[model samples]
Each structure stands twice: as C-alpha cells, then as structure tokens.
Target: MTTPQQPYQAPSAEAFLMGGGGAPTAKFPAFGTTVSGRVTERPTVEQQRDIKTGDKKFWSDGNPMMQLVVTVQTDQRDTSIEDDDGRRRLFVKGQIQKVIADAVRAVGAPGLEVGGILSVTYTHDGTPSGPGMSPPKQYTAQYTAAATAMLHASDPAAASPQYAAAPPQQYAPPAPAQQQYAPAPQQYAAPPAPAPAPVAQQHNPAVAALQAQQQAQAAAAPPPF
Candidate 1:
C-alpha cells in the first residue's frame, strides 16, 4: 500500500506583507544606493518582460529570461517610488539576481524566506561590451538567516532601541549592601551562690547530762592538782 501525500496548503497573505494591499515596487536610480529590510515573503521567479513593449524577454541563449521577486518591510524611502508604506517589492534581475543568490548560498540558506533580512546596494555601472549598448548596473547583496534575524527580534534586550543606539551598559547588580553584623557582647552572668547548710541541734537529754558530768569531773581534778 502507498502512503497518502499531504495536501499542499498555501501560506497566509500576511506572510507576504500584503495584509493591507500590494506593496509598492522599488527602483534604484543612482549608484551607491542601498535598500535593506526584513523579508516578508519568499523569493519567487517570474518571466522577464520589457516595460515599454509589454513583451517577453529572452537571454542570449534563447532561454526565457526570468527575475526574482522579493517582498520586504523597510524603513528606507525612495522619492522615485510614490508608495511610502515601508513595504517594498524588489525585482531582481541580471547581475543583481546572481549577487543575491550568491549571498544566500554563502550563508547556507536554501533560499530567502519571511523573517530573513536582505540588503542590496547598487555599487556602480558596469562597462558595456557592445557599441551603443547601455552599461549594466552592478549590485552587492547581503543576507541574514531567518533564524538569526528572529533571534535578534525576539530577544527583548537585543531589540530594545536603547540597546541598538548604544552597547547595553553592563548591568552589575549593586553589590548586595554589605551587612556588617557585629555580635552584641554577651552579659557576664555569675551563677547564684549556693545556700549555707543548716547546723544540727542536740536532741538526746541523756547524752547532754553525760557531757555536763564529764565537764564537772575535769574541773574538780584540775583544782586537786
């Protein structure tokens, strides 16, 4: 018996940062420009086309030319693009695509995903090979893995604005107030003196009379001597 395959479930639209509406497309108009943001959607491949002619473009080898589309939530703003909702849809093609792909691979990520960070910078214009051909735009890219980005985001201490503005001040709990506990001097207590023993009294009358008679005989014998 063959095991049944699980049904495919589509990701939520919010994952693409499309909860409100479609994100505005980003454009790079100058060299040395950069755009960085958290990726809100996985990169997708799409057919490349000419914006003016609305026709499909092909590579020199006659293969269908394609582009990578990535959606991100960024704070960077571009005057050329009207939408300033901070969400941008990046269309990566030609040299830029390779740069981004290489960056992702270098970090050992299979591909870009939501929660990952992507930064792309247009470094300079490349020299054109043929006459009258426009120079290609060169780009540099950087990527942070989703897990690493999430760790920074989820940590309260790391995500604090104060922490980013400056290195977190080392928190040394004030050395617990030293308590100088001096033992109080014990009072000197002398043990109470024992009570005096009681003296015994003579109670026998006969014994008392014999003692008196002996005393009388001794007195008389002394006088005769």
Candidate 2:
C-alpha cells in the first residue's frame, strides 16, 4: 500500500522565520520608525496565516512570506537584545524591500548580505488581506539617510551569499550629439608670408670680414686627396 502525500502546512507567526525563540510579536512597530543593523538572520519562508486556507494563492510558494530578521541598535530600535528583549524584525517586500535593498546596495555593499548591515524605516500600504475586519496590515519598506548612513559605513557579511543581487549594468548615456559635421574644415587665406623677414642685409662689414678670412683660410688649406 502507498502512503498519501500530505498537503503543506504553514508554521505559525510564533514559528515564523525559523521559529527561533518563539512566534514574532503581535505587531510590527508603527510606520516611519527607522530600523537599522546587520541582518542577524537571512530571509526565510513562512506562511502568512497560521491556519492554511489550503489555497496557495501568492507566489505558489505555499503562501510563503519572505522575511529577513535584523537587529537594530539605533534609537529606532523597538526592543533591546542586550536587555534580553527581541530585536526589530522587518518583513520586507516589493515597496519596502526594493527601497531598502537598493539603499543598502547604494551604501557600498555589493548587495544585502546576511551579516551586512542595513537601516530603513517603514510604512503600511494599508492593505490588510485576512479573514476578519481587523486583518493584518501589509507594510512597505522605506529608506533614510539618517538611519542607513551607518549601515553604508559598515562592512558586514552573511553566512552565505544569497540576497546580494548582481549590480545592474550602467552604460553611459550614448553622448547626446547628432551626426558631427566637424565645422566643414574652416578654411581662410594664409595672411601673406609676413613680408619674407625683409631679407636681412648680410652685406655688413663684420660679416664681410669674417667671410673673407674664412675664404682665405680655405684657399691656404690643402685640398683633400
């Protein structure tokens, strides 16, 4: 007899992102709060709802949501690790991840490395997709100089290279010019020969004497064989 293949079930938010310590907190921080630090944990897939509707709607990854957990030490930090509290874990996606990952890359990182540091603020797109009226809010990532500046300054690495995407090729703007005509080789008259320098009169006494002396010496010198 063959055993049946079971359907995929998503882990709870408490089990989200590897279920490290416990499920994630009940809520993410308010919008626009800057969060910055190295990514303590790389991105992972977890279901959005603890209870699977059995319909794998998005990405076909079984409603697997992409999450990258980072530790923020800046004032934007919602919690403290040193104090035994959890760090702020930003769940990034298109609007937010595009902005933040771009900014992180702009700041000297080849890309968003695991250990590589990052700092970004976030806001909700206000689109909640869940069962009841008070469904969970979807958030978009935001980038700021004040928060991410240090991240740019930092040089961190990840356990393995994954998130760092290849830099886009930047070609020069093709030199904004139409077919060059080269001014048609500007031709002008040569302005006369400067009067040929007045044909300097070498018929002077000293020159004449020197010539005479040289000629006499030549006459006196024996001819070559």
Candidate 3:
C-alpha cells in the first residue's frame, strides 16, 4: 500500500538562511566583481498564501519566490583607446532566484519559499561599450563580490564522495511466527491431599493426650471449615 503524503510546511528564508541553532549565511555562488565593492541590501519579506487545502500542485518540488538584486560595475571598451583602461565604465543589474529544496529547508517560513536577491550586472544584448557605435565592443566580465560570496553556500555536501553515490536501501528482516501442536485426548490428575498440621497446647499429660486425640478425630472428618 502507498503511504499518504502529508501536508508540508515550507520553512522560511530566515530559517534556511539561519540554519537551526546557528546564523544564516548565503550558500549560492558569489557575484559582483573584483574591481568594486560588493554589498548586501537589507532583506525584505514577501507574504504568500495557500489557495487550496492539501494542494499537491504547490507540494511538488518548486523554486522559492525569493531572489536578490545585484549591482556590478562593467565597462564598455572604447575602440578609440589602445588598452583595457580605454573601456568606458557602466553599471549592470540582474535578479537571482532561490533553489526549491534549499528554500524549503530554510527556517521561519514553511512551504517552498526563497530569499535573497540577484546581483547587478548580467548578460544581455548590447555592445560591450556604451550607446551604439556600430562595431559593438566587448568587455571582460566577472561576477560581483556579493554574488561570488555564496558560491559554496548552497552545496554543503558537494565535496563528499557519498553525495554522488545512490542512497542505500532500507529493508527490515522478517520475524519468526508462532508454532502450534496437535491436540491430544484429555486426561485429568487429582490434586495431592493437604498436609496435616501440628498442635501445641497441653500442660498436663492426661489433657494433652485427650486434646491430641480430639484434633486427630477432627482432621479425619471431611473438611467443612
């Protein structure tokens, strides 16, 4: 028989960001560039609600809604100049979303949710340089420092050899059953007779003998007391 699935409460971004019993740190790949400073903007909350009870649609693996906005410095190369310095500088921005499993594992919120934002610069159509001059220039690019900082946060187990292998199967050994014997024709045995009790009473020999005789007579009779 298939086991019924239970309703899952997605953990909050804070919980995931702040691992249980510890502080939360980003686990994604790093962003931003080597040339300029990388900064983290304060985190913000986005409220979500469930539209249906026991909704399987949202229960399946899904990405968190949280993402980050990253800003990075980029420069458009100036064909007019000779070296790399000749490039004209410009700022670029983009958004990065959260992974589902990681989000669900986060702390505060329950259900699939994401936290964080995308860094500034991203790839899009345009010459490496500023406003069009026809020969579209290209520039060397790198992730911003903020974006790069989380490079290893998401994958804590990647370095382990066991992470790549298949999980082990769990099977319990069977238990032994009770045995039964064939019934035989019945025969009953009589219980043993009760043992006699000793009497300690007389001061005179004559009285003692008489009392002993009386007690013996009482014991010989059928048990009525």
Candidate 4:
C-alpha cells in the first residue's frame, strides 16, 4: 500500500530567518541597539552572505563564514530593528557571539531555547584592526531559562523567594530521627525485707511461786493486828 504524504505547513517569518529549513526570501535587519524580549526561536547558525553582491562569504582560512540567528518577541517598540509585528531577529557574530555565549555559559545552559528571556545591549564600539575598516561593535547579554522565566511570569511572588529559603522536596534532608531515651531498666523485684528478730519467752516458774507465798503471809499478819 502507498503511504499518503503529509501536508506541508508554511514556516513563520521568524522560522524562515533562523535557518528552520526554509528559503531565505525574507531579510531581517540586524540588531542596532539594545533590545530585551522573550525568545520566539532558538539559535541557529547559517552561512554568511555579502549584503551587496548576495554571494556566500568566507573567512581568511577559506571556511564559509557563519552567523548565529535568534528571533525574539520584543518587550518594547523599537522602529529601527523590530518588524511591524514587534519581533526582532538578532544576527549575532564576532564580539556579540562571545558576549551571548558567555552569558549562556554563566547560566549553565547548553544554549538559548524558545520561551527563554534574552536581553542584549550594544555597549560600545571596539578598536578596529586596520585604519580603513570600521570598529567592531561590543555587546553585553543576559539570559533566563524558559522554566525560570515562565515561573516568574506566571507568579511574580515566586521570584522573591530564594533557592536557599525553600529547597527542592526531593533534595531536602529527611527529618532527623526523633531523639529517643529509654527509662532506666526497672529492677526485677526489690530485695525482700529482713526477717523480724524472734522475741524471748519468760521461763521463770520459781519466782512466781515465791511471790504467791509472800502475799499469803502478809494477809494473815494484818488480821491479827
């Protein structure tokens, strides 16, 4: 049986510029000044071309020159770079690449991704290598991951809490074992009380007889007097 082909979906303008398997019919102006926005397209590398001649460019080593492109939904209006839809395509190279790469590394991410927030500032111009050539532009950049950016966006209060304040549930240490103390072991039984001492019995029969005789003689003498 022959399988049916899937319908082709037209790529967005942002996708077309970011090397998303689309023809380069659209041209997006390079970022001229500082811009801040949420990333709509991930970073993509494409061959650099001459602006005037529309010919592929190469470096001194004969390798094809490459440029990194990223698309962002801008936060504010900037007529210079952003399109009518408020999306700006960042054509990153040379000094700008180093700045963005350093920022990504600082955040411990592999690279920029969709839904992330990116802010790039054109700080100043760099010293030119030759007299006739123009000076290179310098830049500084900052990035926030998608998850972190979304968290802050969804709940503004979430950003105020520090990581140290609330550790992840999985990483939290188990509660310390409850302090346990056992009562002193009870004695099996108290020692039995000492046996009472035996009492002595009077065995003086002779003294009893002498006392009876003296009492009888005194009675007889009193009657005579």
The best candidate in terms of TM-score: 1
- Residue by residue across 158-193, what tens digits does model 4's lDDT show? 755543355556667788899799887655553344
Candidate 1 colliding pairs = none
The lDDT for every candidate, in the order shown, is 0.77, 0.49, 0.35, 0.69
Itemize residue pairs with steric clashes in candidate 2: 14-23, 96-141, 115-157, 115-158
Cα displacement (Å) at residue 170, model 4:
36
Model 1, which residues run further than 4 Å from truth? 1-21, 60-62, 77-83, 163-225
* Model 1 agreement with the true structure over 81-102: per-residue lDDT tens digits: 5657688888888788899999
Candidate 4, which segments miss by more than 4 Å at Cα?
1-32, 78-83, 156-225
Question: What TM-score fits each model?
Answer: 0.60, 0.36, 0.17, 0.55
Instruction: Give the Å error, residue 200, model 2.
Output: 99
Candidate 3 accuracy as lDDT: 0.35
How accurate locally is residue 27 in candidate 4, as Cα lDDT from 0 to 100?
32
Model 4 residue 70 lDDT score: 84
lDDT of 3 by residue, 3-112 (tens): 34444655545446744521222221233232222223333333222336633222234532323222222233444444433211122211123322232234333422
How far in Å is the alpha carbon of 129 misplaced in model 1? 3.0
* Ten contiguous residues with the weakest lDDT in model 1: 192-201
> lDDT rank, highest first?
1, 4, 2, 3
Report the C-alpha lDDT of model 2 over 22-41, residue by residue, as the tens digit.
42332446766555655544
